[model samples]
Target: MDSSIITIFLPIALAIVMAGLGLELTPNDFKRVSKHPKAVLLALFCQLVILTSIAFVICKVLTLPPLLAVGLMLLAASPGGPTANLFSYLYKGDIALNITLTAVNSIIAAFTLPLIVNFAIQHFMNDGQHVGLQFSKVIQVFLIIIIPVCLGMLVRYFRPELADKLNKPVRIFAVVFLIIIIIGAVAKERSNIMQYIGDVGAATVLFCICSLVIGYFVPRLFGISSTQARACAFEIGIHNSTLAMTIALTVMASTTIAMPAAVYSIFMYIFAAIFGTLLNRYAPSVQPSIEQAPN
Candidate 1:
């Protein structure tokens, strides 16, 4: 809510989180994309196109308030996080593909996020109601999203031991910061928190289901293996809500625009676990290829 917090602390917190994500990545993760081109492309199409379209339709059909609609769009645009890899690992999905998707998605999101958020701002927010991510602000968003990630990758490249040492603590901090951001967003709008939930709850839930379904089924339809489909499901279904919330609050300067991500964060893990269980129970078995376990 405060100017300093939005302009200073929030970006710094998000940079730390992105850096932590980078600590887990390496050149190999990106290169792994070459091994499964169809799966990777299908997942990206689902994430970049289908999922955002679903969010838009849900918002339009649900008739969400402007800020809330934008918030949901922002959440849709965010990349997958490390948690997706963990979910894939837990449920016999291809964790390597998850890692690869996450790596590629994070890179793609740095550009697409700004474009999507800017479009949402223009379309959803009323004239003079909120600032859009125009040229300068878009540049700021790019820096906030990408620069720290590159720096962290550099750290991993140069000081492997330090990167390893900082990894867990930074991840812990990322989780803690996400909790605090959710609380702050809720507290800042406490009077309307319940109403916001009521407005966005069904939309977020349906969007999550649609994401998981599309992420999985679209690739399967294209002849992707079940394990890879599972990876796509989790990667597309579990968004980096921390990134969404940070951009909403710090870049957009609107708590109302952070509410969807806060609410979605609450729903994602529960829904992802359920979706994973159903897949595991019903889908035909394909023996998982032994890969390096997710750290």
Candidate 2:
């Protein structure tokens, strides 16, 4: 319950995860963003527009507390990470596009995430209470997400084989690390579990569905292929709740604020899997490869 404990645990966990992220990536991953501007822009648009709007509605309609509401907004603001790439590969979505989107989104989120969270706190908690983003917390994000990533990129630059070899173990660590964070968060907030179960659970599921729907529709309107559309849908729909939890715990030290994201982490995985199955079954066939570069 101590603020210092939460602050200390959250950043260390996030930093480890970021280091795992770095171990798996190459400088080429970041470079891919420039090569696929359309896909990148499309994902960004969905994140800012569709996801944010849905989050606002959920927070308001569900009457989410200020901290939880802000947490949801933070989660929505984050981009797909390595997990999205793995999911995309599993679901036969474009792996390259997933990587490019993840790389770009992570970089953009440093600025966008704080802005979004701060706005949500102010908007939802119009009452006298004010919750602002601390400069120190944002700096922690920079250190956790950005700095480790740069180091990993350097590893790839100087030691390609070493980077490649670390990938599997790092990925394994990601899974374990994520599980611990979720479990610990749940344990810490065990008393509030019932209070949050219905509202946070239902809203998280709805948000995930909306994310997938928007993910598919926007790209389809832009004439992107069904496969890429599916990829974007999952990427944009299922946020990196880990990032949200990290920020909540490290910066705000409020378990209440971290609830939505913790709930979301569970919901998105289940919902996205179901959505992927339905999309693959019911969606129209991909016309022979169009060969257009992903924007």
Model 1, backbone clash pairs (residues 3+ apart or across chains), number: 0
TM-score of each: 0.94, 0.91
Question: CA lDDT, every prediction?
Answer: 0.87, 0.75
lDDT of 2: 0.75
Q: In model 2, which runs have C-alpha deviations exceeding 4 angstroms?
A: 1-5, 126-130, 284-295
lDDT (Cα, tens digit) per residue for candidate 2, span 1-295: 5566566766776776776666666667677666666766887899887789888988888887777788778778877757777777667677666766677777788778878877887787767875667788667666677887777777777888988887788788777766777787888889878788765888888888898889878988998777777778777876888777777767776777778888888878888888878877888545322235444
Evaluate residue 38 in candidate 1 and report its C-alpha lDDT on the 0 to 100 scale.
Answer: 77
Q: Worst 10-residue stretch by lDDT in candidate 1?
A: 286-295
Highest lDDT scorer: 1
* Model 2: pairs clashing at backbone N, Cα or C within 3 Å: 36-295, 37-295, 38-295, 39-295
